[model samples]
Target: MEQRHPEKRNDRNTDLTSDQNLKDRPERQESDKAEQDPGERNAIDSNPGERKPAEPNAGERGSRERNRGERQPTERTSGERQSVERASGERNPGERNPGERNPGERNSGNRQGNDRNQRDKDRNEGVADRHEPVDRVAPDRMAGEIAREGRRSADNGSSERQDRSAGERGPADRGTADRGTADRGTADRLVVGITLGDYNGIGPEVILKALQHNRMQRICTPVIYGSMRILNRYRNILNLKDWNLNGIQNISQASHKLTNVITCWNDQNHEIQPGKVTTEAGQAAFACLQRAVEDLKAGKLDALITAPINKQNIQSEEFTFPGHTEYLAHEFGVQDNLMFMVSETLRVGVVTGHIPLGRVRSSVTRERIVEKLNLMYQSLKLDFGIQKPKIALLGLNPHAGEEGLLGQEENEIIKPLIKDLREQGRLVYGPYPADGFFGTRSYRDFDGVLAMYHDQGLIPFKAIAFDEGVNFTAGLPIVRTSPDHGTAYDIAGKNQADETSMIQALYMACDVARRRKEHQDLEANALNPKQVVEK
Candidate 1:
């Protein structure tokens, strides 16, 4: 009996030198038995000196393992054992498994199956994980997966668990949450109310036309207070079949994405004679105005834009006031309000609004002029974002009363008011003659013009900006604007009327509302001058 090298046992014709080696080294014998296949082990034990079958090469053994779908025990080095373990789906602790693909590897069908299985597991756990890095997931797919997971949790009645999961979400999920918050915030555009004035006139026509612009929908949510039946008729008459309105019963149901119409009257049988000023039209107009004003007062509306309404036709027991401006002032409990006419180039306010020519002389007092000027000044600063407003005062008489020759109202009342105002550190100029002031385009030199009467201011305003003028009521607690025109019975249903004024009025209302909010914010957060001095 003799010792033999273990490496020499793999030779095709080698024989064990002796059985004494196996007896002497029991541990080596057991190791060899464990490492060798059963057939080889049996052959070696049967006859120690017998020649064993030639050992298969590494490639052949691997091919045989694949064909048999099982691993065959064979003597191998440490590195070779690791390779075999990896091929057999076994690994050391913390070592990556064979199923995991490297970055450069092509995605095979098996990898896809593994990914799907992982996703299914995540869903069962009520988690929205892709088992991949956040950057590797497409943004849209990530959002969709999160939404699906949320819905699944809701379906399972696991709202509490859903909330907990949201709290535990990573940065990508938090980003999605922030985007959702921003989408909701974007729906907070100014809610503007448009009152369909004098339905028998051009009110409905211009309203439909104004709302057709896509920009209107982007800037504000328009709620029309009128009869939807009449609006639809006008829409069809104007050949605007493509336009649509979301009809809701109440202002709360108004949609931010569509132009909403709230039906104020249910007079389905009422005939809409576009050019006629009938009692029914007046009553219907009042109904719409009343409902709109109710909502305006309740703070549901951010701003209001009224279309043209016939003054004589709209007058009733319920609406006894002269016009929208006066009615809004009385409703808001304000004694003094100015009729502020606004355009891109000129801004005018009347000292004596809706008064007769004879009363204009009486109403053009020093106190009244000062009140209107103060209102215009404040409106310019707050609504128009003008800090130091320069205003021009139009005279009550011709040539500013020619120094008391033509009329003494201007020389006595208006001149004295202007001088006193200038003394008090206010930018108040002239008692300029109304005719020459506008004829020379002097209105452009000032921030606002104070007229002695309504027609005096509005006549020139409409003449200059007939298509774009906005009539804003100054000194009120709320923002209100309207087209600087009346209900045009001449072109009521013809569809020939211009909608520019109505569009500009709506724009001005939203602009003024935003400016007022900004002003209020600045006032609220303003630093105290006295505190600064003390510091």
Candidate 2:
């Protein structure tokens, strides 16, 4: 061979083209059929030390592969360019160099990331951001979705005045909310579940009286869960019972004559003789309460208003439950409960309810009193429709123990609880010797009282508002209102059982229902989206 200079070996093909071709090669068909092929290109570019062979069609190998490679970017669609930047780790078209970014593309990603971070910050702060975290949606928020803003602290004085506009505007805004809830009732009157207390008592009479009015029909479709036999007796006594009782067995089980109807469930025709006190009557009364509780649980009844029951009667037949208050609490699985008397002037809640005086000392703790006071306050506002109800807290000791000289309970127990309640914005005042406070008609000013003992609140309560007071179970899941009196056995047969307490109970039920209807409407709207289309 003629002597060739080393400089000539670096030809046009070996210089730029060879290095550039190194970027893409191999995967050639010439490599596969080695018998018929010579240029057997390898797919994997070997390390500099060793070059692997027969990598056919690898690394952009073609007649004009380099030209095609140069043309790839210009030929790519915008979406493909974006995808290449994403999947192939290619730089964005505008800035494919270090220490720089494509302004438009970079700005787009920056804006999205910033929006996501801002949404997260707003959620933690409870701000109403347009975009929210999926997990932080109120429905997905851990149970107990309390109002995040303007929360009423447990330590402020309640009488501290809010803006007059806030007070005035609440109802005006509520008008819209109430209109929302009315959708269900207007379509079909609200199904009101009424439970008769003691059939032998005045449970049957009150129902006949309360339902005879046309107003109840306009507001609710009243369903009484009791025996048809007793309802018949009530209708007969009122003469309108003879007129057109329009009474039925079940909601779906109505007769032709039972058209504008009184709804009765699971009708048992036990002979109901007025003034007759028997275990059968007791069992029937007990059954009625149980049935009403089941209906309330099943959501068939919008609200339940119970009549007076003889405590002795409900406690009979091994149902030996203390009374309706305890029995209903047990039935509905409610642990925290209190007996409240709701009247126009004042509300009274018994601390150690239905238990004897001896047990009062042990049961009436500062903690229990404080909790009861809080519940009472909330209940008065929510259930009784009281606005900023004032509360009078009584002392366990007579003359409030003359300041611990006579007894230590007033000083040791009541004072601390009152202070705690007062700190929580409750209008609570007393340890005022029970005698002087209630004796002077001072309770009249307050909306409610938390008596240290059951009899302490009830004695004065019943004495003044006997026939008018409505027995209420505060802090319960369901609505329960009844007459605060016992079955008047003395006047049971005389037709002289003054229906005053029963009437009060009916009115109380109506008032509570109306208010509940209003409040539920407010809460539902605040919780729902703007566009709600019912099916």
Q: Which has the greatest lDDT? A: 1
How well is each residue in 1-535 modelled by candidate 2, as lDDT tens digits? 2443323422421333334434233532233343233433332233323444543233323312322323332254334445666675766443344334322345456545765564445434422212111111121221112212112211123212221222333454645544444454345344566776667776676566555422243334566777666776666665543223445555544221112344343445466667767766777677777777777788766667777676765666547777877777877898878889866666778788888878889998877887788789888898866788888877788787887778898888888877876898767888766678878988778888878777788888888888678888888877778877776655553455566666556555655666676788788877456566677
> What's the TM-score of every candidate structure?
0.66, 0.60
Clashes by residue pair, model 1: none
Q: What is the lDDT of candidate 2?
A: 0.60
**Which number leads on TM-score?**
1
Scanning candidate 2 in windows of ten residues, the lowest lDDT window is: 131-140
lDDT of 1 by residue, 430-529 (tens): 9899999999999889999988898888899989998889889999999999988889889989989898788778777877787777677779999988
